[model samples]
Target chain A: MNIKELHRQYKKRLAKEKRWIRFYQLLLLIGFFVLWETASSNRWIDPLIFSSPSRIFRLLMDMISDGTIFIHINYTLFETVLGFILGTLIGTILAAILWWFPTLSKILDPYLVVLNSMPKVALGPILIVALGPGMTSIITMGAIISVIISTIVIYTSFRNVDANYLKVLQTFNATKWQMFKEAILPASFPTIISTLKVNVGLSWVGVIVGEFLVSSQGLGYLIIYGFQVFNFNLVLMSLLIIAVFATLMYQLVEMLEKRLIKNE
Target chain B: MGFLIVENVSHTYFSKDAATEALQDISLTVEEGEFISFIGPSGCGKTTLLSIIAGLIRPTAGNVYIENQKVYGNKDLSIGYMLQQDYLFPWKTIEENITLGLRLLKQDVDRGIASKLLKDVGLPAVEKKYPRELSGGMRQRVALARTLAVDPKILLLDEPFSALDYQSKLKLEDLVFKMLKQYNKTAILVTHDIGEAIAMSDRIILFSPRPGRIHEIFEISEDIRRLTPFQARSHAGYSPLFQQIWKELERLEH
Candidate 1:
């Protein structure tokens, strides 16, 4: 066959392979839900504890109709997003400062390692006392863990930027600020984006944990309330909501990474 | 007066526990619009000398001068240094990478000049492509364009073609030589290849290893000066010059 005909056949095969993969992914998702529903309806497992898909769906609908789910979602999302933004912003600024001031960075390097290793969840009650019980406390709790991680990751990336690129700038008689802008900033951008992805999950966990301690209105509060009232279904529903929202947030970060990489 | 002068320059890399001398009291003068090559073995400190000239590093004992001004550190005295690796910013497109020096200098980036330089390097169609998307040779061409964009009076090339394949190296040598000559810019290239030094340079400065000191400077025969690197390789005197430099390098090897 001619080259064009061969190329066409190759493209067809690739398309067919992609379609099969997508089909299998959808099938797997459906299969998991079907098996869960079947096992619960047949009493193969205790539905009260496991709380199958149908029961959770009904509970989700009930919450939505009462508009409670939206309020909870909005509150949780606000805390998480605020924490993510503040954490990343503070972290990046601090990392840049550390890079600019090497002596200070050296002094604080071991301290930062100690802070990073400390369990942030153990500090929940202290955060509540420091910031008081509210959105501010929840957001602050989330930001604390994320800030330290982002700072360390970004600072390490900054220090490891290619020396050759910096030499290129130096040859042009570039100022220190110019070197940071031209070489250091652009080179460290990928690491920064990856940090954003990591901060999404970290911020979510921090908010949820904070909410469990002091929140009156959020998914975390609902889970704790459900456990107290012995409404296992409600607890399962809250968990499902948190999982979906977290995945969506992570996917959003992934999308942003794709766009940024494409532009680069 | 010479356009560029190196006076008793020496560099010793000092660490916490050791001091390693890379270049001895190397002194040389390069005329305006002349192409010179520092040819030596691996540890000769030829690259160290180029970095010192480019003001990236200060020598231990002496200084370099351009137009009677002493090179203490980075000044606005337009000197371009090209490395063995392209060192093109991978995040940027070819056009952006080429204009980086101009951007950093707060000068206007002239698209016309960038295109012209790319055209001169025979890569007229890759302005929007990222460095990694291009071959090793194309990236180096973009790097050369970047160095030229700032309009440097002197170019320091540190084995710029060493990383390329043989065919790409030959092609790049021709284009680079012709471009330098056409621009009438002074250039100092440090290389291990004797043929490259003979074909591209007006004078070749041979150096000895371990404390890189100048051994001898050979002026190219007049007839070879008019030819491109590709044509110069086939010229009758090319083999003899290559053999002579080879013998000198072998003597230094011992």
Candidate 2:
């Protein structure tokens, strides 16, 4: 079978998708702009309290010219990147440890569930107490949230490896390292990449929520400031910006996963 | 004592729930360079016997002797086992999967050895291919090459070709026959296929069910072993051989 044929099918599907993308984007732009103008013209909402699309666009232009938005955006992006790396690293290591020691994995299983189920907002005060706010608090919270997801995914993936593969290795009198290197790791790679994809959205949630708890900068801080000052357009602007960046990260992860799996 | 001896073995899987005996008081001997086939009804401890020899499971009451040395507790790299399913690593190329055993053994796997094996198995072009890229017959051939790559003294096969189509099955049977003949390797093939047992094996061990013990052993003539799988079916003497084997099978079926 020509694998290129299979990939051609994917490309064809993508072609159909882009047409829909263009269609929806055009509709969304027209709809949102028309709604903003109509609401403004009719004085349905206060202009200063909830700025229209034109006003928000002007604010965006000014922010871009002065690089104020860029600076804050970069800082938030840097924190997320750091947290993403740290959380993924720690989570992978912890998962390996848990898998290595089954008794420990068993003992920690219930505690991990509890931690996962706990209200993340309740941890805000504790995070501020420990990290004293700023990038530190945001990064810590992001790591805590994302690391759990990574651990659970990696652990499950490692456990779910093909028994036949293991049997082959065992028959060969393979060392533990060899078994892990050949069978366990390769089998879990796709899963780990998918886990990373899942964590992208989760890390964004972490960073934004942590920022709401405490931060003088970032899109999250801007959202809170807009709400307090009653600037609805700026709130929507921040939300959109965060959404775009998170989506970009998720796409990048997916692209990387495809490449990695294909190369293997 | 034979070249490889299995002396009265047993196993009882004890659980908090209950204990189940898997094998009981089994003893057997196989000579060097012998081609043996194990034929039995399902759940007859046939696989349990193979697993014991492969060192995957320990026989509770018996000892396994290979080359007159006790084989239990020796995790030393010695034997090679081929399972019922091809168990080819999908992620790995055919050549890589074939070389897996040799690489693990820290043996300098000669390219010639791999190439020759591939050629011998009619899969020279398939070296760079992955398991998914190959057909069921082709995959099993690669698996056989992988088992052979170790240059093993004893080959333990568990229903190695039971999954193949009729044409592939017959062809693979021919290939296996050629390999066993060429290398003079002792092979223990576990198959329910009476035709396969008769066509390929020098000796057939008929097994009874549950606490599986040897029912009987039939030794084929050297003249019959010389015949190709297709020709063997047409041999004048083949009918009586089939009749004798069928009689054992019919008895076991009851």
Candidate 3:
């Protein structure tokens, strides 16, 4: 075959492979729900704890009809997004500060290690006491969870940029600030985007745990309240909703990554 | 007095365990628009001397003067430096990279300048493309354009063509030589290649290693100097001069 015909065949094969992979993904998701429903209804698993997909879907319908699901989802989504933005922004700024002052980074190195190692969720109670048991405390919890790790990772990337790039700028008699702006920050973009992807998951964990502690409102509260009342369907419903939103947020970050790093 | 002067310059790099002298008592002078090359063995501190001359690094004891003024920490004098590798910012487009020095200096970035430099470097239509999109030689050409865009008073090229394949290296040497002559720009090249030094420079300074000092200087004959680098390489005097430098370099290495 000619090159054009061969290229056409290659594209066709790639499309077929993609279709099969997507088909399997869909099949797996459906098979999981079907098996869980069958097991619960057949009493192969304890229906009370296992809580079939149909039961969860019926519970979801009830919550949707009552319009109560949106409230919890909205609260969780807003807190997670704000917390994620604040965490990434604050961490990047902190990293820039550390980059600007090497002496400060050296001084804070041990403390950063300590703070990063300690369970940030464990600080929920203290945050609740200090910031009060409200959205403020919960958002702070989310922000705090990812900030230290982001600072450390981004700072490492900043430091690791090729020194030659700085040398080029220095030849032009560039100021320190210009070096950071033109070379260091832009060079560290790929790292920053990857850190954003990690922070998405981290912020969710923090917000959920904070809600569990606050015991006020959100998907985490729903899960906690469901466990107390023995409502397995409610817990399952909240879990499924969280999964969908988290994946959506991750996909959004992926989209942003593609846009920002178009040159590479 | 020459256009650029290095007077009794020496440098020592310090670490916790030891302080190593990298360059010692290096003094040289280049007349205006003179093309000079420093050829030497590795660790000869040719690059260190170039950095010192560019005021990127301070000499341990001595001074570099450009047009009767100290070069160290002097911002008014523009010095263009090109490295072994292209080192173009991957995120920046060719246009942005070329205008970077002007922007850094807070000068009004003239759009015409980028296009003009690109044309001069024979890379006219690649302004919007990133550095990664170009070939190695092409990227290096873009780097040259970027360096020249600021209209530096002196250019310090640290093994700029060493990374290229032979054909591209020869071609770039010709291009750089022609452009420097066309603009009447003063330039200093550091090279490990004796032939390249002879082909491109008016005067070649061969350096000795181990506390790095100048060993010898060779001046090109007037007949050989009139031609482009590629033509100069094919001239009768080229091989003899190359042989002499090669023998000097061999002796230094041993």
Candidate ordering by DockQ (highest first): 3, 1, 2
Model 3: colliding residue pairs: none
lDDT of each: 0.90, 0.83, 0.94
What DockQ would you assign to candidate 2?
0.52
- Looking at model 2, residue A160 earns an lDDT score of 90
- Tell me each candidate's TM-score: 0.95, 0.91, 0.98
lDDT of 3: 0.94
Point out where model 2 deviates above 4 Å: A1-21, A44-50, B111-113
Model 1 compared with the native: what TM-score? 0.95
**Reference A-B contact fraction recovered by candidate 1:** 0.74
- Point out where model 1 deviates above 4 Å: A1-9
lDDT of 2 by residue, B1-254 (tens): 69888888886677999876777787888998888999888878888888888878877788888887777657564787888789888788888998999898888988877678888888867788778878888889989888888887788989888888999989988888888878888889999888888888889888887667788888888888788766676778778988888887788878
The candidate that wins on DockQ is 3
Q: Which model is ahead, 1 or 3, in terms of DockQ?
A: 3
> Predicted chain A of model 1: TM-score relative to the true chain A?
0.96
Chain B superposition TM-score per model: 0.96, 0.93, 0.98
